[model samples]
Target: MTIEQEKFSGGVAVITGAGAGIGSGIARRAGEVGMTVVVTDISAERAEQVAEEIRGAGGKADAMTVDVSKPAELDRLANEVFEKYGSVRLLVNNAGIETIGYAWEIPVERWEATLNINIHGVIHGVRAFVPHMIKAGQEAWVANLASIGSFGIMPVQTAYMVTKHAVQSFSECLYLEMELAKLPIHVSSIIPGQVKTSIFDADAGKDEPTSTARHRQIMHDIMKAGGMDLAAASQVILEQVAQNKFWVSTQPEMTEALIEGRIAFLRDQAPPSLHESARQLLEA
Candidate 1:
């Protein structure tokens, strides 16, 4: 039972991290598709601003502040949405943070923060919203945002990669469980290749050793130069969501080879180093 794009009309979409970047792009697109969009973010002001933009464009939208890392806050968000809207047709767990540094060198606090937001955030959303969705007996979809780094590796980005890999695994398990239960709910793991976003701003500003700082800067530059536009990427993602696709890759051609290479390496075959090309591009 695949959901068509028209099914989104008059539905409710709750998007976390909708204040900026790819999350904001998805919120705006949801509004355009005639869904009542809930723009949620840790930053109240940014959430409000995105909501206002949607409203100004003659779309129904509301803003809510939510720190997805907090389970209680996610519960509150679910309650508010259910009380006001009665149903949520789309739940996007898109809130995430990035930390840079080797696994051993990165602070424990950073590791905890990344795991809480990137992995636990998705879990909290599922725990809070899935029951309501089932009770409502509505066809719904949950899209958990992962990254290419989930399958590929990069130096000095252990924390971010670890969380994304977890998201990929969790999303797959959720999909399988839902399928076995014969539920109307669908799950998708969104694997996005560098979309133009401010995800690296903190890394860029970090007070790191010169070598680490330079590496971070290189990554920022690469993303800025080669990343796809956020709106375009979000459109691709939403289309896949509507079709009930399990694996949503925004840049498949670029990522497929890397994923294949990883598999080959795991089989004890010679495979191209995942980050070698990225490093070469940066040097060039």
Candidate 2:
């Protein structure tokens, strides 16, 4: 058996945003690896559809409606999961939304939603669940979704990019906290590079500035053309998680390149500039 199966088989995994995109892919992969997967999403129908797919395939799964933007909701979810399963072996804070617009042009509601879901969601997910995992005193894993955007700068995607940067920093600090406490809980920052997901769907950006439609479509096209397959990326992410890696990346080369660019920018105190591709996309 592979390390992933050896480590995660017969465990319970709780994943947020498992109705679609990377979250759903990881949920399916978890079920395939012999875990009982709890698939949570804001949309009850989407969550149940994924859960049914897993169950139909002879894997174990359950669906629940969860809005990760609320801390109280996450607390309730943690309590319910622990009560039902006795222990949770994996927790993935993977629910996030992408908002496309010039920072000033974005609506107040969109800005708040982006910040609450992308940043606070991950924070509260950790806060609400860690205590339970600690009390259980069993080895567990927590993976937070940090994007390649964490290491770079973007203009129109300011809201989403900032949240990713926060998640990356949060994960770094969380890893150290686990080490200091000598806990069996492992923390991983999942940096995905262009994974094929519905993050940039037109309907998802309805709340953003109307002028952002072109930019949003450009990004959606780019993702469709070049992003890695969702299932493949999920496999890579979970494998690294099973190995207890602190930095789990679907595309290591992309992560390395972004990190290198970030290092140079910091070392030289360079003014932020858009890449050629980004310029083309934004200007299109």
Candidate 3:
């Protein structure tokens, strides 16, 4: 069924990580569409900044500080938003952290932090918001941010890759469950290739070994050069979501080839070279 754009007007949209990058881009688009945008972030200042910007541009907006990794905070956010707005029409679980290192070489704390924010954060959002959305009986949607890494392998990024893969799987299951229950809520897995974001600069301020620093530098350079514009990518994502489409891919052609290569490998062909795939993506 085709979803009309008017459905978003006057709707309540809560977006995690709305302080910067892709999240901020999505928040701006939501505001432009006349949605009451709730810009939530771990950084209170940044969240407030985004909320104010939206209001300045003639949209309804609010700011809230929420650490999505914490279930209590997310639950409280849900309660407060529902109390004020009465219902939520969109939930964007976009908060995530990146840990760059081989699976075994990464510190335990880093791995835990990555999983808590990237995977469990989305889980907590679903747990806290789905019930309320159901009770409200409003047409709603959840957009979970995964990555191209969800379907492809990248060396020294095991932690980020693992969590993104989990998000993809979780989103798929959520879609099926909602369909089976005949719920009005829709779910989407936002599988983006690189978008211009500071996520790659995460390791810049860290005191890491020479090799780790070098690796991060290489990644940072590649992404900076090739990543899609944050605004453009966000627009593509929300457009697909408005249509209730799943598999929200930013770079569809590249993503399709990666998935096809994975299938080919599973069919007993020569394993696709991860480095080759990454090189092509970086060049693209």
The candidate that wins on TM-score is 2
Ranked by lDDT, the better of candidates 2 and 3 is 2
**Best prediction by lDDT:** 2
Clashing pairs in 1: none
Q: Report the Cα lDDT for candidate 2.
A: 0.95
- Segments in model 1 whose C-alpha atoms lie over 4 Å from true places: 1-4, 202-211, 269-275, 279-284
Residues 159-249 of candidate 2 have per-residue lDDT tens digits of 9999999999999999999999999999999999999999999999988888878888988998999999999999999999999998899
List the candidate numbers ranked by lDDT, top first: 2, 1, 3
Q: How many clashing pairs per prediction, in order?
A: 0, 0, 0
Candidate 3 lDDT, tens digit per residue, 192-274? 88899888795432633334555676788888999999889988888888888888999998789778877777788675566
TM-score of 3: 0.92
**Residue 193 accuracy (lDDT) in model 2:** 95
Error of 1 at 239 (Å): 1.0
lDDT of each: 0.87, 0.95, 0.86
Model 2 ranges off by over 4 Å: none
Query: Candidate 2 at 211: error in angstroms?
Result: 1.4
Q: Give residue 97's lDDT in candidate 3 (0 to 100).
A: 75
